[model samples]
Target: MKVNELFKEELKVINMGLRSFADDVKSQDVPVLHVDWRPVAGGNKKLSSLLSKLKSK
Candidate 1:
């Protein structure tokens, strides 16, 4: 597909980790898929690394 084709299509957004952003985008009447995402271990780097290692195995 060409870059111009993307501009012709309707705008859609996948807002992750921030509901406020999704709400802001929705105010413009655009399609949005809001994902209430967060870090695996509350943004704890060491624990997240350990969990990632476990998941890989």
Candidate 2:
């Protein structure tokens, strides 16, 4: 599947045919599954990096 990486999320590309009611009714029964990835980096690391680079007020 052509996947894009952004917003720290992975998405599956669905075809228009699969979205139609006729396809759902006439086609063989199929199941769709979704998988999610967990964050590898801690929140503190991201915050500290930003804080270190913050422009002085």
Predicted model with the maximum lDDT: 1
lDDT of 1 by residue, 1-57 (tens): 677997999988999976999999999999999997888899999999999999999
- How does each model score on lDDT? 0.92, 0.45
Model 1 off-target regions past 4 Å? 53-57
Extract clashing residue pairs from model 2. none
Candidate 2 has its poorest 10 consecutive residues by lDDT at 31-40
TM-score of 1: 0.63
Which regions of candidate 2 are displaced past 4 Å?
Answer: 1-43, 55-57
Q: List the residue pairs that clash in candidate 1.
A: none
- TM-score of every prediction relative to native: 0.63, 0.20
- Whole-model lDDT, model 1: 0.92
Predictions: Cα RMSD each:
2.6, 13.1
